[model samples]
Target: MQYKLPVSVLVVIYTLDFEVLLLERADHPGSWQSVTGSQDEGESLRETAVREVFEETGLDANHYGLVDWQVQNIYEIYAKWQHRYAPGTRHNTEHVFGLELPCVLPVQLSPREHLSYKWLPWQEAAGLVFSPSNREAILQLPAREKARG
Candidate 1:
Protein backbone atom coordinates (compact mmCIF):
# COMPACT_ATOMS: atom_id res chain seq x y z
CA MET A 1 0.00 0.00 0.00
CA GLN A 2 1.11 3.56 -0.63
CA TYR A 3 2.05 4.84 2.79
CA LYS A 4 0.05 7.96 3.52
CA LEU A 5 0.79 8.41 7.18
CA PRO A 6 2.51 11.75 7.71
CA VAL A 7 4.78 10.24 10.35
CA SER A 8 8.52 10.74 9.96
CA VAL A 9 11.88 11.07 11.67
CA LEU A 10 14.32 13.96 12.01
CA VAL A 11 17.89 13.09 12.89
CA VAL A 12 20.10 15.87 14.17
CA ILE A 13 23.50 14.72 13.02
CA TYR A 14 26.16 16.16 15.25
CA THR A 15 29.62 15.45 16.61
CA LEU A 16 30.84 14.66 20.08
CA ASP A 17 32.03 18.26 20.28
CA PHE A 18 28.55 19.56 19.31
CA GLU A 19 29.23 20.40 15.68
CA VAL A 20 25.95 19.85 13.82
CA LEU A 21 25.59 18.78 10.24
CA LEU A 22 23.14 20.59 7.99
CA LEU A 23 22.19 19.89 4.42
CA GLU A 24 20.86 22.26 1.79
CA ARG A 25 17.56 21.19 0.30
CA ALA A 26 17.84 20.48 -3.39
CA ASP A 27 14.34 21.74 -4.06
CA HIS A 28 14.88 24.89 -2.01
CA PRO A 29 18.53 25.78 -2.41
CA GLY A 30 19.06 27.89 0.68
CA SER A 31 16.90 25.77 2.96
CA TRP A 32 19.01 23.63 5.30
CA GLN A 33 18.12 20.91 7.81
CA SER A 34 19.23 17.72 9.48
CA VAL A 35 18.47 14.29 8.03
CA THR A 36 14.71 13.87 7.65
CA GLY A 37 12.33 11.56 5.79
CA SER A 38 8.91 9.97 5.90
CA GLN A 39 8.52 6.58 7.50
CA ASP A 40 7.68 3.53 5.46
CA GLU A 41 5.13 0.88 6.36
CA GLY A 42 6.07 -1.35 9.29
CA GLU A 43 9.14 0.74 10.12
CA SER A 44 9.74 1.91 13.66
CA LEU A 45 10.79 5.52 14.20
CA ARG A 46 14.32 4.48 15.10
CA GLU A 47 14.55 2.31 12.02
CA THR A 48 13.34 5.20 9.91
CA ALA A 49 15.95 7.47 11.46
CA VAL A 50 18.76 5.06 10.70
CA ARG A 51 17.62 4.49 7.12
CA GLU A 52 17.21 8.18 6.39
CA VAL A 53 20.64 9.07 7.75
CA PHE A 54 22.28 6.55 5.49
CA GLU A 55 20.09 7.44 2.54
CA GLU A 56 20.66 11.16 2.81
CA THR A 57 24.18 11.44 4.25
CA GLY A 58 25.78 7.99 3.99
CA LEU A 59 26.36 7.89 7.73
CA ASP A 60 25.89 4.58 9.49
CA ALA A 61 23.62 5.37 12.41
CA ASN A 62 24.93 2.40 14.36
CA HIS A 63 28.58 3.48 14.11
CA TYR A 64 27.85 6.79 15.77
CA GLY A 65 25.96 7.80 18.89
CA LEU A 66 22.32 7.48 17.81
CA VAL A 67 19.93 8.63 20.47
CA ASP A 68 16.22 9.06 20.28
CA TRP A 69 15.44 12.19 22.25
CA GLN A 70 11.99 10.58 22.74
CA VAL A 71 10.59 13.88 21.69
CA GLN A 72 7.84 14.20 19.13
CA ASN A 73 6.62 17.27 17.34
CA ILE A 74 3.35 17.69 15.53
CA TYR A 75 3.12 20.68 13.25
CA GLU A 76 0.97 22.07 10.50
CA ILE A 77 2.26 21.18 7.08
CA TYR A 78 3.61 24.10 5.16
CA ALA A 79 1.49 25.08 2.17
CA LYS A 80 4.44 24.81 -0.16
CA TRP A 81 5.35 21.31 0.96
CA GLN A 82 1.91 19.84 1.38
CA HIS A 83 1.81 18.63 -2.17
CA ARG A 84 4.23 15.84 -1.33
CA TYR A 85 1.64 14.32 0.94
CA ALA A 86 -1.81 13.00 0.28
CA PRO A 87 -4.67 15.41 -0.19
CA GLY A 88 -6.09 17.07 2.91
CA THR A 89 -3.08 16.18 5.00
CA ARG A 90 -2.69 19.20 7.22
CA HIS A 91 -0.15 18.00 9.74
CA ASN A 92 2.84 15.75 10.30
CA THR A 93 4.29 13.88 13.27
CA GLU A 94 8.08 14.09 13.55
CA HIS A 95 10.18 11.96 15.88
CA VAL A 96 13.43 13.63 16.87
CA PHE A 97 16.77 11.80 17.03
CA GLY A 98 20.38 12.67 17.62
CA LEU A 99 23.34 11.07 15.87
CA GLU A 100 26.63 12.11 17.41
CA LEU A 101 29.83 11.27 15.61
CA PRO A 102 33.46 11.74 16.63
CA CYS A 103 33.89 14.61 14.18
CA VAL A 104 32.65 16.03 10.91
CA LEU A 105 32.55 13.03 8.64
CA PRO A 106 32.47 12.79 4.86
CA VAL A 107 28.95 12.86 3.41
CA GLN A 108 27.45 11.36 0.30
CA LEU A 109 24.37 13.41 -0.32
CA SER A 110 21.46 12.29 -2.44
CA PRO A 111 21.82 14.89 -5.22
CA ARG A 112 18.12 14.77 -5.94
CA GLU A 113 17.25 15.63 -2.35
CA HIS A 114 20.11 17.83 -1.16
CA LEU A 115 22.49 20.30 -2.77
CA SER A 116 25.26 20.34 -0.17
CA TYR A 117 26.21 19.74 3.43
CA LYS A 118 27.77 21.86 6.15
CA TRP A 119 29.14 21.22 9.61
CA LEU A 120 28.54 24.04 12.02
CA PRO A 121 28.35 24.87 15.70
CA TRP A 122 25.06 24.10 17.42
CA GLN A 123 23.95 27.72 17.55
CA GLU A 124 24.74 28.29 13.91
CA ALA A 125 23.06 25.08 12.87
CA ALA A 126 19.98 25.97 14.87
CA GLY A 127 19.81 29.37 13.21
CA LEU A 128 20.38 28.08 9.71
CA VAL A 129 17.55 25.54 9.65
CA PHE A 130 14.33 26.79 8.13
CA SER A 131 11.89 24.79 10.21
CA PRO A 132 11.15 26.03 13.68
CA SER A 133 10.83 22.53 15.06
CA ASN A 134 14.20 21.57 13.60
CA ARG A 135 15.80 24.64 15.11
CA GLU A 136 14.23 23.86 18.44
CA ALA A 137 15.62 20.35 18.27
CA ILE A 138 19.11 21.64 17.56
CA LEU A 139 18.92 24.16 20.35
CA GLN A 140 17.94 21.42 22.78
CA LEU A 141 20.94 19.24 21.97
CA PRO A 142 23.22 20.52 24.68
CA ALA A 143 20.64 20.17 27.39
CA ARG A 144 19.74 16.75 26.10
CA GLU A 145 23.37 15.68 26.12
CA LYS A 146 23.87 17.04 29.60
CA ALA A 147 20.83 15.26 30.92
CA ARG A 148 22.04 12.04 29.35
CA GLY A 149 25.40 12.49 31.03
Candidate 2:
Protein backbone atom coordinates (compact mmCIF):
# COMPACT_ATOMS: atom_id res chain seq x y z
CA MET A 1 0.00 0.00 0.00
CA GLN A 2 1.15 3.52 -0.68
CA TYR A 3 2.05 5.46 2.43
CA LYS A 4 0.77 8.88 3.27
CA LEU A 5 3.23 11.71 3.45
CA PRO A 6 4.54 12.23 6.95
CA VAL A 7 3.84 15.95 6.79
CA SER A 8 0.40 17.42 7.30
CA VAL A 9 -1.26 20.74 8.12
CA LEU A 10 -3.64 21.66 10.94
CA VAL A 11 -5.48 24.93 10.45
CA VAL A 12 -7.26 26.55 13.36
CA ILE A 13 -10.07 28.48 11.70
CA TYR A 14 -11.38 31.12 14.05
CA THR A 15 -12.79 34.61 14.21
CA LEU A 16 -11.52 37.64 16.09
CA ASP A 17 -13.94 36.85 18.89
CA PHE A 18 -12.55 33.34 19.24
CA GLU A 19 -15.42 31.52 17.57
CA VAL A 20 -13.77 28.55 15.92
CA LEU A 21 -15.11 26.68 12.92
CA LEU A 22 -15.13 22.92 13.32
CA LEU A 23 -16.25 20.13 11.01
CA GLU A 24 -17.50 16.73 12.10
CA ARG A 25 -15.60 13.92 10.47
CA ALA A 26 -17.76 11.86 8.16
CA ASP A 27 -15.82 8.75 9.17
CA HIS A 28 -16.11 9.48 12.87
CA PRO A 29 -19.28 11.38 13.67
CA GLY A 30 -18.29 13.02 16.94
CA SER A 31 -14.76 13.80 15.89
CA TRP A 32 -14.67 17.52 15.14
CA GLN A 33 -11.71 19.65 14.19
CA SER A 34 -10.47 22.63 12.25
CA VAL A 35 -9.46 22.15 8.61
CA THR A 36 -6.75 19.51 8.26
CA GLY A 37 -5.16 17.39 5.52
CA SER A 38 -1.99 15.82 4.32
CA GLN A 39 0.39 17.74 2.12
CA ASP A 40 0.38 16.78 -1.52
CA GLU A 41 3.59 16.07 -3.30
CA GLY A 42 5.31 19.28 -4.49
CA GLU A 43 3.15 21.37 -2.13
CA SER A 44 4.72 23.70 0.36
CA LEU A 45 3.36 23.80 3.88
CA ARG A 46 1.72 27.14 3.09
CA GLU A 47 0.20 25.73 -0.06
CA THR A 48 -1.10 22.74 1.84
CA ALA A 49 -2.72 25.03 4.38
CA VAL A 50 -4.41 27.17 1.75
CA ARG A 51 -5.56 24.23 -0.32
CA GLU A 52 -6.94 22.36 2.69
CA VAL A 53 -8.83 25.39 3.96
CA PHE A 54 -10.45 25.83 0.58
CA GLU A 55 -11.13 22.14 -0.05
CA GLU A 56 -12.55 21.50 3.40
CA THR A 57 -14.46 24.73 4.06
CA GLY A 58 -14.85 26.54 0.74
CA LEU A 59 -13.24 29.61 2.33
CA ASP A 60 -10.31 31.27 0.65
CA ALA A 61 -7.33 31.58 2.92
CA ASN A 62 -6.29 34.67 0.98
CA HIS A 63 -9.38 36.43 2.32
CA TYR A 64 -8.22 35.96 5.91
CA GLY A 65 -5.09 36.13 7.96
CA LEU A 66 -3.37 32.77 7.58
CA VAL A 67 -0.68 32.53 10.20
CA ASP A 68 1.89 29.81 10.39
CA TRP A 69 2.71 29.15 14.02
CA GLN A 70 6.00 27.59 12.95
CA VAL A 71 5.25 24.73 15.30
CA GLN A 72 5.61 21.06 14.42
CA ASN A 73 4.18 18.10 16.30
CA ILE A 74 5.40 14.52 16.06
CA TYR A 75 2.91 12.03 17.40
CA GLU A 76 2.21 8.34 17.31
CA ILE A 77 -0.35 7.30 14.71
CA TYR A 78 -3.47 5.92 16.34
CA ALA A 79 -3.79 2.17 15.83
CA LYS A 80 -7.09 2.55 14.05
CA TRP A 81 -5.55 5.06 11.63
CA GLN A 82 -2.30 3.30 10.97
CA HIS A 83 -3.69 1.52 7.95
CA ARG A 84 -3.64 4.75 5.98
CA TYR A 85 0.09 4.87 6.18
CA ALA A 86 2.83 2.60 4.83
CA PRO A 87 3.86 -0.50 6.65
CA GLY A 88 5.90 0.24 9.75
CA THR A 89 4.85 3.90 9.75
CA ARG A 90 3.99 4.79 13.32
CA HIS A 91 4.17 8.58 13.52
CA ASN A 92 3.39 11.78 11.67
CA THR A 93 4.67 15.33 11.73
CA GLU A 94 1.92 17.93 11.91
CA HIS A 95 2.47 21.60 11.22
CA VAL A 96 0.18 24.10 12.86
CA PHE A 97 -1.45 27.08 11.15
CA GLY A 98 -4.18 29.60 11.96
CA LEU A 99 -6.78 31.27 9.77
CA GLU A 100 -8.37 34.26 11.47
CA LEU A 101 -11.40 36.04 10.10
CA PRO A 102 -13.40 38.99 11.41
CA CYS A 103 -16.44 36.83 12.12
CA VAL A 104 -17.95 33.42 11.61
CA LEU A 105 -17.90 32.80 7.88
CA PRO A 106 -20.04 30.56 5.76
CA VAL A 107 -18.51 27.22 4.89
CA GLN A 108 -19.17 24.50 2.33
CA LEU A 109 -18.23 21.17 3.82
CA SER A 110 -16.70 18.50 1.61
CA PRO A 111 -19.44 15.90 1.83
CA ARG A 112 -17.08 12.97 1.56
CA GLU A 113 -14.98 13.94 4.56
CA HIS A 114 -17.26 16.00 6.77
CA LEU A 115 -20.91 15.63 7.58
CA SER A 116 -21.56 18.93 9.38
CA TYR A 117 -20.01 22.09 10.67
CA LYS A 118 -20.32 24.36 13.69
CA TRP A 119 -18.87 27.57 15.01
CA LEU A 120 -18.11 27.41 18.70
CA PRO A 121 -16.17 29.39 21.23
CA TRP A 122 -12.55 28.46 21.61
CA GLN A 123 -12.90 26.67 24.95
CA GLU A 124 -15.84 24.58 23.80
CA ALA A 125 -14.26 23.83 20.48
CA ALA A 126 -11.17 22.61 22.27
CA GLY A 127 -13.22 20.22 24.32
CA LEU A 128 -15.02 18.81 21.30
CA VAL A 129 -12.00 17.76 19.28
CA PHE A 130 -11.16 14.04 19.38
CA SER A 131 -7.40 14.34 19.10
CA PRO A 132 -5.35 15.55 22.01
CA SER A 133 -3.03 17.50 19.73
CA ASN A 134 -6.00 19.12 18.06
CA ARG A 135 -7.47 20.08 21.43
CA GLU A 136 -4.12 21.45 22.56
CA ALA A 137 -3.90 23.49 19.37
CA ILE A 138 -7.26 25.09 20.05
CA LEU A 139 -6.25 25.86 23.63
CA GLN A 140 -3.17 27.64 22.35
CA LEU A 141 -5.06 29.92 19.96
CA PRO A 142 -5.56 32.84 22.31
CA ALA A 143 -1.96 32.90 23.34
CA ARG A 144 -0.85 32.46 19.76
CA GLU A 145 -2.97 35.35 18.58
CA LYS A 146 -1.82 37.60 21.39
CA ALA A 147 1.76 36.83 20.60
CA ARG A 148 1.13 37.95 17.05
CA GLY A 149 0.25 41.41 18.29
Candidate 3:
Protein backbone atom coordinates (compact mmCIF):
# COMPACT_ATOMS: atom_id res chain seq x y z
CA MET A 1 0.00 0.00 0.00
CA GLN A 2 1.19 3.47 -0.80
CA TYR A 3 1.34 5.82 2.14
CA LYS A 4 0.50 9.46 1.66
CA LEU A 5 2.98 12.24 2.29
CA PRO A 6 2.76 14.24 5.50
CA VAL A 7 2.51 17.44 3.44
CA SER A 8 -0.71 18.72 1.87
CA VAL A 9 -2.47 21.78 0.61
CA LEU A 10 -5.75 23.50 1.50
CA VAL A 11 -7.15 25.62 -1.28
CA VAL A 12 -9.86 28.19 -0.66
CA ILE A 13 -11.92 28.70 -3.79
CA TYR A 14 -13.85 31.96 -3.76
CA THR A 15 -15.27 34.76 -5.87
CA LEU A 16 -14.51 38.45 -5.61
CA ASP A 17 -17.49 38.87 -3.29
CA PHE A 18 -16.25 36.26 -0.81
CA GLU A 19 -18.55 33.40 -1.75
CA VAL A 20 -16.39 30.39 -0.94
CA LEU A 21 -16.75 26.97 -2.50
CA LEU A 22 -16.99 24.00 -0.15
CA LEU A 23 -17.38 20.26 -0.65
CA GLU A 24 -19.18 17.70 1.47
CA ARG A 25 -16.96 14.72 2.07
CA ALA A 26 -18.04 11.39 0.64
CA ASP A 27 -16.17 9.50 3.32
CA HIS A 28 -17.51 11.61 6.18
CA PRO A 29 -21.00 12.78 5.49
CA GLY A 30 -21.83 16.34 6.60
CA SER A 31 -18.16 17.23 6.81
CA TRP A 32 -17.61 20.12 4.40
CA GLN A 33 -14.35 21.77 3.44
CA SER A 34 -12.45 23.58 0.74
CA VAL A 35 -10.27 21.73 -1.78
CA THR A 36 -7.63 19.67 0.05
CA GLY A 37 -5.32 16.73 -0.65
CA SER A 38 -1.96 15.22 0.13
CA GLN A 39 0.95 16.30 -1.97
CA ASP A 40 2.37 13.79 -4.40
CA GLU A 41 6.06 12.98 -4.36
CA GLY A 42 8.09 15.44 -6.48
CA GLU A 43 5.17 17.88 -6.73
CA SER A 44 5.49 21.42 -5.50
CA LEU A 45 2.99 22.69 -2.95
CA ARG A 46 1.46 25.00 -5.57
CA GLU A 47 1.08 22.02 -7.88
CA THR A 48 -0.63 20.10 -5.12
CA ALA A 49 -3.08 22.96 -4.59
CA VAL A 50 -3.94 23.17 -8.27
CA ARG A 51 -4.30 19.42 -8.64
CA GLU A 52 -6.50 19.12 -5.57
CA VAL A 53 -8.78 21.92 -6.75
CA PHE A 54 -9.25 20.22 -10.09
CA GLU A 55 -9.73 16.79 -8.57
CA GLU A 56 -12.29 17.97 -6.02
CA THR A 57 -14.27 20.61 -7.93
CA GLY A 58 -13.35 20.06 -11.58
CA LEU A 59 -12.22 23.67 -11.67
CA ASP A 60 -9.01 24.33 -13.54
CA ALA A 61 -6.88 26.38 -11.20
CA ASN A 62 -4.71 27.48 -14.11
CA HIS A 63 -7.49 29.64 -15.52
CA TYR A 64 -8.17 31.42 -12.27
CA GLY A 65 -5.93 33.53 -10.06
CA LEU A 66 -4.31 30.89 -7.83
CA VAL A 67 -2.38 32.55 -5.03
CA ASP A 68 -0.15 30.87 -2.50
CA TRP A 69 -1.01 32.46 0.87
CA GLN A 70 2.46 31.51 2.14
CA VAL A 71 0.86 30.26 5.32
CA GLN A 72 1.33 26.81 6.81
CA ASN A 73 -0.61 25.03 9.51
CA ILE A 74 0.62 22.02 11.41
CA TYR A 75 -1.93 19.80 13.08
CA GLU A 76 -2.41 16.27 14.34
CA ILE A 77 -3.73 13.93 11.69
CA TYR A 78 -7.25 12.74 12.32
CA ALA A 79 -7.18 9.38 14.03
CA LYS A 80 -9.35 7.81 11.37
CA TRP A 81 -7.15 8.99 8.54
CA GLN A 82 -3.76 8.43 10.10
CA HIS A 83 -3.56 4.97 8.60
CA ARG A 84 -3.16 6.49 5.19
CA TYR A 85 0.12 7.96 6.32
CA ALA A 86 3.28 6.08 7.13
CA PRO A 87 3.64 4.43 10.51
CA GLY A 88 4.33 6.86 13.34
CA THR A 89 3.23 9.86 11.25
CA ARG A 90 1.13 11.75 13.71
CA HIS A 91 1.04 15.21 12.13
CA ASN A 92 0.70 17.03 8.82
CA THR A 93 1.72 20.42 7.53
CA GLU A 94 -0.82 22.07 5.26
CA HIS A 95 0.00 24.90 2.94
CA VAL A 96 -2.77 27.42 2.27
CA PHE A 97 -3.80 28.72 -1.15
CA GLY A 98 -6.57 30.76 -2.71
CA LEU A 99 -8.19 30.44 -6.13
CA GLU A 100 -10.23 33.46 -7.13
CA LEU A 101 -12.90 32.85 -9.70
CA PRO A 102 -14.89 35.53 -11.46
CA CYS A 103 -18.21 34.05 -10.37
CA VAL A 104 -19.77 31.01 -8.77
CA LEU A 105 -19.91 28.52 -11.58
CA PRO A 106 -21.29 25.04 -11.37
CA VAL A 107 -18.73 22.36 -10.49
CA GLN A 108 -18.47 18.69 -11.36
CA LEU A 109 -17.34 16.93 -8.22
CA SER A 110 -15.52 13.62 -8.20
CA PRO A 111 -18.19 11.38 -6.73
CA ARG A 112 -15.68 9.31 -4.83
CA GLU A 113 -14.16 12.31 -3.09
CA HIS A 114 -17.21 14.50 -2.45
CA LEU A 115 -20.94 14.03 -2.21
CA SER A 116 -21.87 17.62 -3.07
CA TYR A 117 -20.68 21.18 -3.32
CA LYS A 118 -21.85 24.59 -2.10
CA TRP A 119 -20.94 28.22 -2.58
CA LEU A 120 -21.47 30.24 0.55
CA PRO A 121 -20.36 33.43 2.24
CA TRP A 122 -16.89 33.12 3.70
CA GLN A 123 -18.23 33.26 7.25
CA GLU A 124 -20.71 30.48 6.60
CA ALA A 125 -18.13 28.37 4.82
CA ALA A 126 -15.70 28.78 7.69
CA GLY A 127 -18.34 27.56 10.10
CA LEU A 128 -19.12 24.47 8.05
CA VAL A 129 -15.64 22.99 7.79
CA PHE A 130 -14.65 20.13 10.11
CA SER A 131 -10.94 20.84 10.37
CA PRO A 132 -9.74 23.73 12.47
CA SER A 133 -6.95 24.56 10.05
CA ASN A 134 -9.37 24.63 7.15
CA ARG A 135 -11.74 26.83 9.14
CA GLU A 136 -8.99 29.26 10.00
CA ALA A 137 -7.98 29.49 6.37
CA ILE A 138 -11.53 30.30 5.30
CA LEU A 139 -11.92 32.80 8.13
CA GLN A 140 -8.93 34.71 6.85
CA LEU A 141 -10.17 34.86 3.25
CA PRO A 142 -11.30 38.47 3.45
CA ALA A 143 -8.11 39.66 5.03
CA ARG A 144 -6.04 37.72 2.54
CA GLU A 145 -7.91 39.21 -0.37
CA LYS A 146 -7.56 42.71 0.97
CA ALA A 147 -3.86 42.19 1.40
CA ARG A 148 -3.63 40.94 -2.18
CA GLY A 149 -5.30 44.07 -3.49
TM-score for all models, in order of appearance: 0.95, 0.96, 0.97
Per-residue alpha-carbon lDDT of candidate 2 for residues 11-99, written as tens digits (9 for 90 to 100): 99999999999999999988898898888889999999999999999999988899898889999988988898888888899999989
Which lDDT tens digits does candidate 1 get at residues 54-120? Answer: 9999888988789888899999988887877888889999999989898889999999999999999
User: What ranges in model 1 sit over 4 Å off?
Assistant: 1-4
Across residues 51-108, which tens digit of lDDT does each residue of candidate 3 receive?
A: 8988888889999999898899999999999999999999999999989999999999
TM-score of 3: 0.97
| Stretches of candidate 2 exceeding 4 Å from the true structure | none
Alpha-carbon runs more than 4 Å astray in model 3 = none
Top candidate, metric TM-score: 3
TM-score of 1: 0.95
Error of 3 at 20 (Å): 0.5
Better structure of 2 and 3 per TM-score: 3
What's the distance in Å from true for residue 32, model 3?
0.4
